[model samples]
Target: MSTYTPGESFAHRLDPRSKLAVQAGFAVAALAHTTVPGLAVLTGVCAAILLAARTHPARALADLRLLLPFLVLLPVVEGATLGPPWFSVADARAPALASYRTLLVVLVSVAYVRTTPVRESRAAVQRLVPGKPGRVLGTGVALVFRNLAVFRGDLRRAREASAARLGDERPLVDRMRLVATAGLARALGRTETLSLAMRARCLSWNPTLPPLALARVDVPVLALACTLFTWGLL
Candidate 1:
């Protein structure tokens, strides 16, 4: 999904630090539970968070399309490897639980990503972590998130151009190779240009991040997050 969708929802107004905390705590708690009911509760909480964030369910599902094949294959592979029967319902439980937990984590992360801006994320990290190192780490992280969309766009355009030129006549492998080459070239070029720009601007080890303020609305969300996390742990 787009790292940050512009919205006026309560989630969008919450501090990024709160979102990060909730995501981390929820992930840790969710992983400890293996039961279907427990996972279902965790998934429900994530879904509620998404709803609170005003995130479109369709958009979230669309973003996960890239992982659908892996999600489908993981349970199958896990079930097959565990026992004699290739598709035992018993064998599938563990894998299914694991996959469900993973999905919950992704959903929580998507909620944070959709609501918080990259700058806010950086500021959150910076505030939580003291010193120049925190600044460096936070800036690095924000830059990565910022650049991810650009990289995706580059790959997409490259593939589209390749397809248009070749008209699907070329073999799949050839098309993939061409796309990969183009994407790598574009990434490298971007890196070089970015490096030069940073150098010209006199890159600092400790860049300033904008300040983040948590308001009253964040309290209820924080409380909900804590409740969910504790529930998952129990």
Candidate 2:
């Protein structure tokens, strides 16, 4: 289990793997339908998932903030690849659809992670990968979740160390290069150690054993969610 205790609300009661299936359905539906209205509906569904999970509003907002950088970038690509006016019905549609798709996937993932144990999520994700991808991602989940605070502190210390060494005389570009190199080296070292430690601790992903079972009753609920998303996509 990760130090990050996922909220145990109504939504958390569902099987972790089931929620992931629903996310796959939503993602498929989002890709199938590209209109603004369709995307809005999908975004609303994502918001509803968040609400149902009963996650903290502040945390949800923070997650939204994570999407900000992408929000700024999505429009430029939409305009260049899709068309002219940034705000037009035709031009904005691609970006709007993209924004909503990104939001939907992110929110679903957040809700799932916030509900399931980090290890359980890792195990579920393993089902998707063929050979090495599963193990690699599972390793990330274990190390990243278990030592999240430490990793964050490492990043902060690295940045501060860079800042302290940076003088007014140094060019901004040079400072950035130095900071990037320092941060990358430190991050790589930490990850390598963590990976080795994880292996020593005997971590492996066997997806057959879920922390919670998908109850017989839960199947219809997932089926309903899938049906709704599928119908709307059409």
Tens digit per residue, CA lDDT, model 2, 1-234:
113355657677777677877777877777776676777777777777778787654686575674667875786566554434434556656685677577667777777667777767676666666578887887577657767667656766766876686543578887667767777787789879977986897865543445556787568659956875776467
Q: What is the lDDT of candidate 1?
A: 0.82
Question: Which residues of candidate 1, in runs, are more than 4 Å off?
Answer: 80-86, 232-234
lDDT by candidate, in order shown? 0.82, 0.68
The candidate maximizing lDDT is: 1
TM-scores for every candidate against the unseen true structure: 0.90, 0.73
Write one digit per residue (lDDT tens) for candidate 1, span 1-234: 458889999888888988887887788778777787778777777888889899877778787877767877888876775445556777777877787788778878888898988888888888888988788888798878989889889999999998888736898888888989999999999999989998999987666666788889878768877876776567
* C-alpha RMSD of each candidate structure in angstroms: 2.3, 4.5
Q: Show the lowest summed lDDT stretch of 10 residues, model 1.
A: 78-87
Angstrom error of the Cα, residue 90, model 1: value is 2.3
